[model samples]
Target: MEETITPTRIFSRWRWLYRLILIGTVVLSSVIPVYAQSEPLRIHPALLTLAEESPNEIIRVIVQQNAQERISGGTLSRAGAQVTRELPIINGVVLELPARKVIDLARARGVRWITVDAPVIPAATPGSSCNMLTNPGFENGMTQWDDWENTLDKQISGHAHTGAFAVRLGQPSGAFSQSLQSATAGGTYTASGMFQRQSSNVRMSVGIDFFDSNWNEIDEVYTEIPPSDNYVPVSIAGVAPAGTVHMSIWVWKDPGGSLYLDDLRLHSSSMDSGACAGYPATAGYNVLANGDFEAGTTDWWLNNSSLQVTSTAYNGTKAIHLGQAAGSIAQSAGIALPGTLYTARGTFHRPIGAPWSGMGIDFFDVNWNEISDVYVTIPETSSYAPVTVSGIAPPGTVHMSVWIHKNSGSELYIDDVSLVGDEVPDAFVQSTGTNQLWHDAQPRTGQGITVAVVDSGIADHPDLNIAGSNNSRVLVSEDLTNSADKLKDAYGHGTHVAGIIGGNGSASNGIHRGIAPGVNLINMRISDGKGMTYASDLITGLQWLYEHQAQYNIRVVNISLNSTVPESYHTSPIAAAVELLWFKGMTVVVSAGNNGNGNGAVPLFSPANDPFVITVGATDDRGTGSLDDDVVATFSAYGTTIEGFAKPDLVAPGRNIVSLSAGNNATVTKEHPSHKVGSQYFRMSGTSMSAPVVSGVVALLLQDEPNLTPDQVKYR
Candidate 1:
C-alpha cells in the first residue's frame, strides 16, 4: 500500500471492478422489497421520492379493480438527450417500465429534471369515473388566486374526462347535459340540489334534464328559486332512458343574475312495500253500574218495622222483593225523583196458594199518614200484570212501604219499583164553572184543535177526561219534560187545566166540568210548582209542540209560565230554533208574566216577546159585559216592550176559575174550607187557572171549523 504507482497503471488495474461495484450499488438502490407495514400506503409522496433519488429506476404501479387513474409529468436534459413528457397511469394493472422511464435514465446520465404527480382525479364510483384533461394553470400567466367561477373551472377541469364532466358559468341558462356510463329504464329517478339567486329583484328557474343515448332530450322538470337566503329542495321522479344517457342540471335567469348549485344527488327505484291492514271496532264499557239499584242484599227493600220479606218474579221475569206486615208498616229508601211526581210501579205474579189476597204499597208523608196507595188482587189462575200508583209526595224526604194482607195463605211477587219526583205539578183542584157558553156548537172532540195548557200536569180525572174518545182516538198526550213517562201529574195542575178545557162533569162524585167539554186538551206543563222552568226548557217545549203540529193536529201552543230571559237567550241556539218553528206556520201563546209595573221592566218574557207570538194577559172573572171584561188582572203584567209595543193582546178569566182534582167516588175535604165548593171541589187563583179558558175557546172554534190555522183560531 506504501509503494508508489503510475496513474495510468492504477486506472487500468481497478477500472472494471470499480465499474461493476457502481452498477451493483445503483441497482440495489433502485429496487425496493414489497412488505406490509403498520403505516398506511401513500403513493404520491413515495413515487415523488423515488423519481428524485434514482432517475434511471423503472417505476411500476399496481392498483385494485376500481382504483383511480393518475398522471405524472417531468422535464429532463442531458448532454446527448433532452425530454419533457406527461404519462397516464391506468389503475387495476401492473405496469412495467413505461416511456416516461427515459427521463429517469436521462437523469441518471447527470441531466437536470423536475417531476410531478399530475392529472388529479376526483373520487368517484366504479361505474362513473373522472380525470382532468388539461390545466390552463393561470390566466395572464400570473399565479394570483382566481374568482369563484375560475376556481370552479379549475376544479371541473381537474376531473372532466371518463364520463364525468363539470363546468362553471357566471350565469346559468337553458339546459346542460353530461354523458353517463350507464342508464336505467322504467325506474323511478330522483335529483336534488340547492339553487340561489344573487339579485333580490331577479327570479331563477332551475331544472334537471334527461337525454337518450343519441343525445335526444327525453324529459325535463323546472322549479323556481327566489332571490333569498333559502335552500330549496328540488326533486323529480321519472323513468330513466335506456342504455347510457346523460343527466344535466340547468338554471335560467328571468333577469340576468348570479346563481349557485351544490350538494347534488341522484337515485333510482328500489322495491315494493306495504303495511298491516284491517278495520278495528271501537271499544266501549257495558256500564254494569248505570244506576241500577244494586247495593245491599235486602233486595232493595227498606224495612223500618217487623215484616216478612219475600221475592216475586214479575216484569221481564225479574225477581222483585216485597216486604209485607200487618199494623201500618212504614219504611223509606233512596229513589230517583224526576219532575216532582212520585210513581210507584211494579208487576205482580199470580199467588202460589190463595188468589183473593191483595198486595198494596202505601206511600206515607213524614208524619206517617198514607198519601197514596197501590193495591192489586190476584185471581185464581196465575197471571202476570202491571200495577201503578202515582201521586204527589211531600216534596222532600218521605217514606214508602209495600205490604200484603193475607185473608188466606197467598203469595204475591212485586218487581220494578221506581220513584221519580222533581218539577212535579202543583195540586190544583177544579172549580165547576157557574155560567156555561150557550153557543149551540156540536160538542168538539178536539181533533182539529190544539189547546196548550200551561200548568203542573193533567190527571185522568173522569169529568175532566179529555184524553181518549169513545172511538179510542187519543186527541193529544205528551210529556213536556225531557222524559218518557206521560201519564203522571206531580202537583195536579194538569187535572185542573184539563177541567178548565174539557172536564166532562165527572170527578170526586161530580163537581167540576170544564168550559168546553168537547175541546181537545194539550197538557203543556211548564212549572214544577216549587220554581219556574228554565227559559231554555220552556223554549224546547214550545218547539216540540210546533214540530208535532200536523201530527198531533196542533194549531196553537200555550205557555202560561213566565221566566226572565236566560243569559243564553241573546245568542241561544234553542231560541233560534224556536223562532224557526213560529215562522213555519204556528201560533204561540205566552203568558205576560206576573211581575207588575217597574221602571225598564217589561211585562212579557220570551216566547211572549218573540215578536210573532200571541201574548195573552189575565183578567178576573168579574164582568159579564162587553170590553170591560178586558181589564188586566192586578197581578197580570201590563205589556209594553222596552222598545214599546202594546202587548197583552187580550184578557181572559183567570181568577178563581173552578176546575177538577184527582179523586175517586169518595168526596175529600178541602184544606181551606172557605175555598170548597160543595163537598168535592175547591177554588184557586192565578193565570195558571186562566190559560185553559182560552184553550177551551180555541177548541170550540176548531170543532166548528176543523181547518183553522192558529192565527185564525186566535182571532176567533
Candidate 2:
C-alpha cells in the first residue's frame, strides 16, 4: 500500500474521503432543530394569530387536554386563567383568559389545543308563530297550567334551552298539563317542545287528550322524544276527534336520570266554532267506578259506618245498604259540561215503613261549592223500585257527584246506580282490537289523519259528521264513476266501507261504532249501484288522490274492489296506478277478492296482486272480541298472486261485519233486507268489508307515526 502511493493515487483517495465527510455533515444538519423563541408549539393556529393581534384582550376558550393529562385548576389560576366550565363529557374545560396568556398556557406540558369558545344559539321556540300555550317558556312561573299545584316544585332555573327557567322533573310519577278549550272537533293542532335529559336512560312523552263537550275523554295521543345530553326539539300534530270540544297538552317523564323541558307550544289551524257533530259514545259511559258496589266501597265516600255493602240484589249480586237513618254514600263522578244532558238512575228497595230514600246528582263549581242538586225519591215498596232523574248540566258546573241518602230511621237498599252521559260507545268496537287502543293510556282515534275510500261513496250519516261543528267528516266526495247519485252511496258498499273506517257510532246510540271513528275520509266514488265499476274509473280515482294528496292530507287509500280478470301486476293499468301512488308515499290497501271458496285458489285481481300495495284477506272473529275461534272466511281470497307473490298481506275481521247502510232503497240494502241493521246500518260478508278494517288500522298507524312511508307502513 505504501509503494503504490503516487501523487495521483494520494489525490483520488483524499478527494473520496473529503466527499464522504461533506455528505455526513449535510445529514447532521438536516437532523438538528432550528429555533424561534416566540413561536407557539402546541397552540391552535387560529388562536396563535388571535394572540398576536390582541395580546391583552380577554376571551373565552375551550382547552382540550391530552390523554392521561389533566390541566390542574391551580396551574390555570396561577396563569391568570378564569375557569368557566369543566366539561367532563368532552374532556375539556372552558376558560376566560387574556390573549397573551393563551400562548403561555399552550406551552405547558401535555397541552393539546385551544380554540375560541363560540356562543351557541338555541332554536327558536317551536310553534312560536301561533303558540296556544300560555307561559310556554316557563318564564311565567307555572301560570295557566292545569296541574301547577303538583308541579310547583318541578319548575327551576338555569337549565333552559333559551329562557331563564325550565321544568325539571324530580320524579316520573305525574304530568304537567294545560287544558286548551279553544280546540275544535275536526280541527288540526300541532304541539311541540324542547327537552333534555341528564342520562340516556330517561324517556319522555308529549301527549294530547281530546275531550267532548260533556268532558268525557274521547281520545289521547302521545309522541316520544329521543334521548340527548343537550336540548332537543320534538313535535306532533293531530286532528281533534269528532266529538272533541276541548283538549289538553301534557309532558310525561319516565323513571331514569334527570329530565328538563321548556318552550311547550300548541298551534291550531282553525278556531273552534261548534265544529263537533255530536257527543262521543264514551260520554254515556258510567262515570262512577263503584256504582255497582262490587269492589267494596272503594270509590264511594262513606259518610258513616251505617252504610255498608250487602247481598241485596236489584241487578247485581251486591248493593249498598243504608242501615242507619240519615246515612249517606256519595261518589264524585267527573267534571260536567254545560248544556249537556246527564242521567242519574238507580234501583231502590226498603221495608214497608223504612225511611224515605233518594238518589240524586250534585253539581259543584271549580271551588267544590255546591251549585245545584236534583233528586228522585223512590216510591216506598217491599221490592226494589227504579228511580230516575235527568237534567241538562247547568253552566258553571265543573264537578258532578252522585249521592244516596236516607231521610229517617230504617233500612234502605240501593243498587244499579249509574250516571250516564248522552253518548255511549258501541260494544262491537272491542271485537276489532280497537278496544285495546281505546283503553290505552294514550288512545289513538285516527285524529288529524285522512284516509281515502275509493269505492261507491260515503252517504250522509250522523256518524260521518264532525262533532262540535256543522261539517261532514267526508272532507271531499269525488264522483269518478259518473253515477246518477252524485256523492251518494247508491250501492251501499262504500258507505259500509266508510263506516268501518270512521263511523263515530253516533247512530244506534254508539252500539254500531266504526274502528277509527276520528279519521277524516275522502270519498272517491268509482262504483255505481250493485258495486259495478270499470278499471278506468279506479285509475281516475287514484289519479285524483295522487293530485290532491297534499291538499287533503290523504295518507292512506283503500281500494276494496278488483278487476274481472286476473292479470300480471306489471302490465295491469290499475295495478300500475296503485303502485305509482304507493311509490308517491301513500299506503294503498286493497282487498283480496271474495272468490276463494276454501279451495286455496290464487286471487283473481289486479291492484290486490300488486306487490307494492298492502293486500288484505278476511277472517271471521265469530262475533266475539276473542280471536280464539277466528277462521278465514270461505270467500276471502288467499294463496299466491298471478305475479307469484304471496298474499294477502294480512287478515282482518270481515264476516257479517255491521257497517253503515246507504238507505232502505239502496241496491245492496234492498237486495239484502234481511241483513239490514235498523235503517242506518248493514251487515255484509266479503273481503270488501275486510279491507276497511285494515284501512282503519292504517289510519291509526299514520296518526301515531306520521313520517312513515308506504313501504314502512307495509313493513310495520
Candidate 3:
C-alpha cells in the first residue's frame, strides 16, 4: 500500500535527521581537540614536543603574563629569550628563545599561557624597507613627538606637503624628537622628512641621536639641508653606535627662519630578514599569511580562549571558529605609506540564529598605535557569505591589520581571509593572445563598440568605470528582475563577464586589462540578486536590448547563462528572442553550459542550442601564456542538440580566469571564497567565462570594421 506524507510528518523526519547529525558533530568536536588543547599542563603540546625533540633549537613564542607582573627586557634576557615584537594589545611579547628555556620561562613569577609565535603578513612591502617612526607626517597634531623648546604650532588649514596638517616651528634653533624603541644597535637607520621654508636663506638639519642604557646620548649623525622655497624632501642615513639600546629622530633648523615640517619618516636602510616571508608566495593576491586556517592559528592573534581553528570550512580543509563574545582573529603588517589603498575580504557562516559579524582593517601609525579602523558587516545568513571593506589609508598610516571580528552572537565560522593592495594578475588575458594583439601596428580596442552583459547586474568598479571626454563607458544599467531600475552586481557574475569583455584594468595598474577595454558596456540585469532568473526574464532583457541597440551602438550581446531544461531551438522562446536580435545585426554569444560528461553525448540546451547565435565552450589554459598545454574543461558542455545540430561554435580560455569581483556581499565570492584573486577580482571557470571572451572579440571586430553584419563578423 502506498502512503501519503503530510507537512508535520516531513518536519518530524527532518527533525530526527538534524538531531542525529548535530549529535554526531558534537561528539566528534569533543574528541578532536583532546590532543591539541591538553590545557591543564599550561602549555601547548606542540611546544612540549619541540622542547623534548629539539632542546637547543631556537623557536618563537608569545609570552603572556599576569596583569600585575611586568615582563621587562632584563627578565626576558635572563631567560635567554630575545624579544622580537612587543604586542601591548594583548599584554604579551613575541620572543625567540631556545626550546629548553621555554619551560623555565613559563615557570617565572606571574606567568600566563604561552603559544608558538606565528608570522603575520604585512599589508604591503613598500619598495623594500619598512617605516618605523610614529606620527612622522605631523597628521596627529604632534602627538608622538616632543618639542624641545615648546614653540611649535600645528598648521591645520593649508601649505602642508601631504595630508591636512603640518608642524610649524616658531623658534629657529629649536628641535623636535621621537624615540625609536625598536631600533637595532648595529643596524643602519634612515631618516627623511619634507620641509617647506618660509624663507630660502634658512638651513634645515635632521639626524639620529643614539642613546645608551642610562638614557644618556652616546653619539649623533646629522644631514644638512639646503634652502628651498617649495616643499623639498631630504633624507639622512646613520648607523647606530655600539652599546645603543635605542635612538631618537631629531629635526631642527638654524639661522632664525620659520620652517614647516611634514611627512617625516624613519626606516632601516636594508630590508628586514624574512619580513616578506610566511605568506603563500604563489597565491597571486592573498597578502595574509595562513589566511585559510589550514595551518591552524599560525599567523593570527588570539587574545581569548574561545577562538579556535576548526574542521568546518566554507571552501577548504579548515576554518576559524569564534565563540567568545568579543573575539577576533587578526594579522598585522607594515604598510607602504599614507594614502595607499587597501582592501580586506573574507567569508563567514553562522549555524544558529544570526548576529552581527564583520571583516575590517585596523590602521596603525609608525609606532603601531591604533589610529583608526573601518569595517563592513556580513548580512544575516546561515550559510557562508562574503564581506569586503575597502578604503584609502588615512594620513600617518604606517601599519595595518585585517581582522574577522564578531560581537555577541551564535558561533561564527570564518575562512579565506585576504588583505591586499589594488592590483590583479593578468595571466588569463595574456594566455588568450589579447595582450599581443593590443600592441599590433593598428591596434583595435573596440573604441566605438558596445557590448551588453545579460546576467546578474554589473557593480561599480574602477576597471569597468571608464570614461572618455564626454560619456562614461557604461551606456545603460537597467534591471529586468523588477527589484530596481538601477543595477548593482549582487551575484558578481555580470560584473566579471563585463570585465572580461572590456575592463580597462584601472584597478590593477593596467596589468589585467581586458580583451577590448575601450568598448562601452550595457548592463542588462536579467537575474535577481541571487542569480535566479527565468526564461521570461531573459526574453525581457533581450527585447530591451534589441530596441536600444542602435541608440547605444550595442554590437555584441553576451549571454553567459543557459536554460535549466533542454528544448528544440525552433520551439524555445529564449532561442526565438536571441534569434530576433541576431537577425537585427547584433552578434549574440551564449555559454554552451557546464554539464559535459566527456562522452560527447550530453544534450545541449537553449538558447545555446540555437544555430543562429554563437555558442562558445571553455578551455583550461592552466594560467600560462602558451596554448601548448590547453585542454577542454571537463565540465564544459559538449554535444549535439535535440534536433541533431552540433553546437558551441568556438572555444576560449576560461578556467580560473580572473576578473572583477563585486564588493557588497556578492554571491559567487561568498560561495567560493578560495577563488578570489584579490579584493578587486575573482577567479571562476566554465563556459560562462568562455562566452565573454568571444563577445569581447566580437566587439573588437565591430570596432575595426563597423560596416560588417553579424554573420560577417562571426565569420571573421
User: What TM-score would every model get versus the actual structure?
Assistant: 0.34, 0.41, 0.42
**Tens digit of lDDT per residue, candidate 1, span 1-716?**
64543323333343343223221111212112211232122232223334343344443332111112222222122212222211111111223343234333322311111112111110001111011001112111111222322222111211111111222224433332223444444445555544445567666665556777776778776667666554444555556644327655444554355554433444443211100000000111111111122222243333323333332334222343333332222225323121234444445564556435454555666676666665655344366666555554444325655543334233444444443332211111112222234233544444445565544555565564444434311355555554333444544445655676666555444335565665566666644432234433444456556557677666555555543321112222223334444544555565555443222343454444544566665564332222322335555556566435666676565544456653332111122334345443445444545566666666665666766655575676
Regions more than 4 Å wrong, model 1: 1-448, 466-476, 480-487, 508-511, 524-526, 529-532, 566-579, 597-602, 623-631, 662-680
lDDT of 3: 0.68
CA error at residue 227 for candidate 3, angstroms = 80
lDDT at 469, model 2: 61
Model 3 per-residue lDDT at 640: 80
Q: How many residue pairs clash in each candidate?
A: 24, 15, 1
Write one digit per residue (lDDT tens) for candidate 3, span 1-716: 84553323433343333223211111112211122222233333445545654577687666644445656555577668887655442335667888767665654554444655421111111111135665565534567888777665423222455443466675447678898765556668888888876766666688989888876888888887667788888888888776787888988776477777777878774333212211111232345788877678998887546887787888646888888476777898544346656878888786555577777898888788888888887677768888789877789877889877777757788898888664225556766677666778988888889999998888888887654343458888987667753448777788888899988888787876778988899988877665666555566678788778889888899998776433455434466568667867799999887655354656666778988899988776644454654668655677887566787888887666777888648866776676567688876666777888888888888877898888997777
Worst 10 residues of 3 by lDDT: 119-128
For candidate 1, the C-alpha RMSD (Å) to the true structure equals 44.8
The whole-model lDDT of each prediction reads 0.41, 0.68, 0.68
**Candidate 2, 21-92: lDDT as tens digits:** 211111111111212334334443445544554466676666655545667665686568887665432335
